[model samples]
Target chain A: MVSALTCLFTPLLRAAELQSSLIASALWSGDSHNFKRQSHQFSLEPEAILRFDNRVKLTALMRLRSISFDGLAPQRVSDAAYSPLGKPLYMGNSSEFELREFYLELPSDNYYFTLGKQQVVWGKADGLKVLDIVNPQSYREFILEDFDDSRIPQWLANIETNVGEWDAQFLWIPEQSYHVLASEGGLYAPTSPLLLPQAPPVGVSVDVKAIDRPGRLLMDSDIGLRLSRFWKGWDLSLNYLYQYDNFALLYQDRSLTANGPHVTIQPQYRRTHVLGGSFSNAFDNWVLRGELAYFSDRYFLAEGLSDSDGITKGKEVSSVVGLDWTGLENTLISGQLFQSVALNRQSATVRDKSESTLSLLVNHTLLNDTLELRLIWLTNSNVGDGLMRLRVTYEWQDNLKTWASSDTFYGSEEGIFGQFDDNDRLIIGIELAFE
Target chain B: MKYPRLLSCWVGILSTPFFALTGLAQEPLSNAQATLPTGGQVAAHINSRDEGEAVSRKLSIVMRDKRGKTRKRETMSYRKYYAGEKRTVIFYLAPKNIRDTAFLTYDYNTPEREDDQWLYLPALRKVRRISAADRGDYFLGTDMTYEDIKLETRVSTADFNFKTVGNCDVDGHPGLHIEGTPKTQAIARELGYSKSLSCVDRQIWMVRQSQFWDIKGALLKTVTIANIDQIQGIWTQQNINVENHKTGHSTSLSFAEVDYQSPVPDTMFTTNAIKRGL
Candidate 1:
């Protein structure tokens, strides 16, 4: 295991106080669709942070996951969009070792620089993610795993400095990596039969294949900017980003074959411009936050068009408003409203012109704060789909916790939650961190 | 997460104790009270003493159940007070599960407004806005309620009538007893208190002990302060304990590594800093 090898370097790196933790968790989950089909998963996460006296800081994190099941099916290749790392790599069912973050930070009086891969979180809205961009995500587990673990880090350069009362952050990424979709036939993948709306009839023998993403690092680079300040109980931020889409759009590559007409599926990225802003204010017993972002030249998949693949250009505006109240007895209640509107209706045909979503969270403590009861509910008004998750956690110590949770979804087949209506699961896991 | 910081309980966002006696409080005093200096004179003297703009300290807090079982928590804190503005941030350093949890609070001098607070939970990877109301709600099941902790800010001279009870020796210091009752039924219910009693150290004008009485004339709780020391030129209480008679529960807060006017960064007192973690 890499953990063994990393352990060897701990002594050499800890002169500046190396901080590290090893977290392992397992869950037994049963799908609602087939009660008889059950699966188990075990994951281990090892992370470490070191700050050198030479004004440099380094952090490394890695995760290994394994799954075991009874009557689990094989990976389906119906859609070539399946992620390579998204599929389970098994000795039975273990994942290949994944290195999540490895970065160096150099700080100075006037400016500070960060080089290497990292996750740059930008929003204050809980669960909304209106402005929390800058990194791609692996939605293989949907929203079950915390973003700290799910948000894929990107190789980039970051610089920040304070000019008078304003703080500014700049980011430049040399390589473009797209979002990793759930593996085909996996738990969270979209499962449905579709009919191509318009297409030329193809000989049953004709074959279709995929071409990978662009390999040249400079061809698809990303850059962003953020300006922020805290004034009079309010924290405000303005942002701009030019990045590739996390989800790829498919385009048809024509080829002449001996059999007849042949098509090659190629993933395409639409260079997008995102302009965003965020604000947070703390008042008596209440905290308020709002965020909004506008996207130019956003791309949309041409759903229902099976014969020929095409990508459409559109625009979008997304916003979130959230609040937290801690007025009750040892209870915290938080809620957020998210709404995204397609600015260009003609090009954005796959989804509705506007979609509104709501999320609510309630947490209460009992038994001298040793036990906590928490519930979160999210619903989309456009699709009439929603998911409710409940969790009970007991803290044995500061660094250890054991939890049992259940996630249930309700919706139509084409909806986000509807597609996985039968994949509802119960989870129990233990996590411990040490340094 | 540090239970205290995660639950935002007993944060001890205390202001200068000497200044707490300046406003409207009521009641008449005994011979003991007559022998001591007036609250005004005592307050003026305390204010004139050496008080700095900031303070930092380590804290060991313990809460005990009725059965005498105890839970211990530890934290390090930095606080800065500037005229009408105050900011404090506390970091949980012990009881490892809650270690690295951080809490930030902003206290405003405006009367109609309440203090602002935020909590960072490493587990959620999020800093949450914690809304606190000075209601009769216990802090993380501790004996001291939010109302009890906000004793100074929630009560004013216009709401209560104060009087001197008598001379008394509090924690081996010469002190004057003071009793205050809400001026109206509404004010009494709002504070969940009918009467408040306190013993003030005559020399330093600091509150050495205090007791709360409910509307039904039953004793609710009593708090004691001890281990006084002059740190950073200011009189500081190193240990404070609270006993809730009705609930039979108690909480004790002990201070250590106390530092005054230390160079705590202004950035350390903000939510952004709290989110960044220790």
Candidate 2:
């Protein structure tokens, strides 16, 4: 898709003012579960910009990543890469060297158009995403990775223009990318009890006979619109999106045994509608932000269901409130409270019907802003599961830095984060930038 | 997306002038108010040649430590003037990591309200309003504080007594010497300065050299301006060097690609411009 755009915009950009930059980083991680190398990763990122006559700008980014696990013979290290290969009918993940952003922006007096692959952020929440759902996520490395690396870009066209002091934007997305989930048997996989009837046969193999992917038909695409305004130093925005669920839903095909049934789950996609809005206000050393979203026709896996009929449709409402403060000389503290509620639904598949989450981030820089220490903590209230990450970095030069980091997860195995409790890790990394 | 911790540094740097420049351009001048042209009026006159002037320039910021070791940053910047209303915006250019960061400021003539300021964070893809200003904190890891670059025009009238102290020479150019004494001892202490003196070149009417005395009545800093050039008939200083005697450190701000009195756009002063990174 990007290649096609490049071909079309090439002639216009050939003589454009050119600029480029490259950022490279490598990381080594060891785990507490077993004192062994848990991850080896190398990443090369390059960004290019071409500006023509001050009217159009093309910005592109390419990310090349290579990751491998410590396959120590004595003991196999648990890792996402250790997952079992998917069934015959599957959407595989081999997207290294992918284009993170390849978009051309055309700006005029009052309107602007952005076309090609891009990430459009729509919400004001921090850590907990409520309405910033314009792009899918890559969770192959779990949620420990920054969203910039996790966000999956889509091919789209965005048109924005102003009306008085208000701004209006329209988006049309033609391509959809699925969220990158962890492989089957990777270290971050569900352990003991989460190995249930659905994820059964933990050590066994499963076969897929059929699959369903997001449609490419124009009528079957995603569309969105947003209107925003800043009044009295406060921002207010309203957004609406008609799109598909980022992940797949499965339907069991049971006909193998008489009376007793063998289930063959068939993966499929569902359509959804999202309506949300955000607000933010900054006052005296602190900025407050909040987002509220409502989802219609949202699908949920029927708890304890054996057949593909497990996918049930329901409605949900989610909200997040966050604040960032810099009252101190070299310190910043931020926190957010997020909550989601399953609307009273016809589907009996709903379990608790409600969930709450909390996130906290603290950052401080010292030594003439050359050294920084940051910590992020997030937890699920209902399941009592939480994840904590810490990083300490010191700048060696204006464009070079080194850091040590750690990740810890704990709680009931029933929680998303708690399932990876045993996969706690420590990492060391360095990154350098050049232009 | 979670923003990189270091990105906050750029955010801080972008907000410095926007918040500090509040009411700085509107010096509220009246030819009759004083026995002589006041500091506010004089500083305002030196800052520009006409209203509604636009400028595009390349700025170099160099920071030096006690031992004279230096660190530098370069920026591509544009300033669009809003007539009657005092407003300006600056955009960063180089240092790949900090590129495209922008700052927008709206200065008001009214002393009752603070300036309207905003910072655009590329990583967050959001333009946020900045409501607070820390006058004492350093700007972008540089030796200069926000108050220093703010020009102190808004407070010049009420906080200090200005007078033509004497005749002085700067860089071999003849100039009128101007001395400012704090109106009160407490006001002097709050500003961390006992007194300030500036030598304004007679031809350009802009300060050629300035000296600051610390709270203890000792030399705290000395600033020298050099390389006078005429860009669009405006006498512009090409290089400014500020040395802090107490810290034994210094900072130099140099300007290039000077374009004065160019056509200015009204939209350039808006928040949308910041988000566009223009």
Q: Pick the candidate with the highest DockQ.
A: 1
> What digit string (tens of lDDT, one per residue) describes model 1 on residues B1-278?
22232422333312112112212232346554476565444434433544457777787778776887676778777777767867778787655456567877776767456667677776555665555453445655466654444332122444456555556566468776656677789657655667776666768766677677777877877777777788867788787777777867788888888788668777778665675555
Model 2 regions lying over 4 Å from their true place:
A1-14, A32-34, A70-95, A190-210, A251-256, A305-308, A348-351, B1-52, B65-70, B134-136, B145-169, B172-223, B243-249
Per-residue lDDT of model 1, residues A277-366, tens digit only: 998776655778889999987765555443245555679899999887765556778899999887764442556778899999888887
- Per-residue lDDT of candidate 2, residues A1-435 (tens digit): 999999997887676898899999988888967856567778889999888987689999887766666231101211221112211111123214566789999998878999988888888766658887888776556777777666777778999998777789999987756555654555654343322235544443444544466556587679999989877767889999998877666665545455344566677678889999998877766878899999987766666643246666789899998888866665678899999887755555534688889999887876545577899999988889999989998777767879999999999877878888878899999989999
- Per-candidate Cα lDDT values, in order, are 0.66, 0.66
Comparing to the true complex, what docking class would candidate 2 get?
Answer: acceptable
**Candidate number with greatest lDDT:** 1
Task: Write candidate 2's Cα lDDT for B7-91 as tens digits.
Answer: 1122112111111111111122244433445555554454443422566667787767776556667765555545444665667
Error of 1 at B207 (Å): 2.7
DockQ for the candidates, in order: 0.38, 0.32
lDDT of 1 at A136: 75
Provide the TM-score for each candidate, comma-separated.
0.83, 0.82
Q: For each candidate, what is chain B's TM-score?
A: 0.79, 0.73
- In model 2, state the lDDT of residue A262: 55
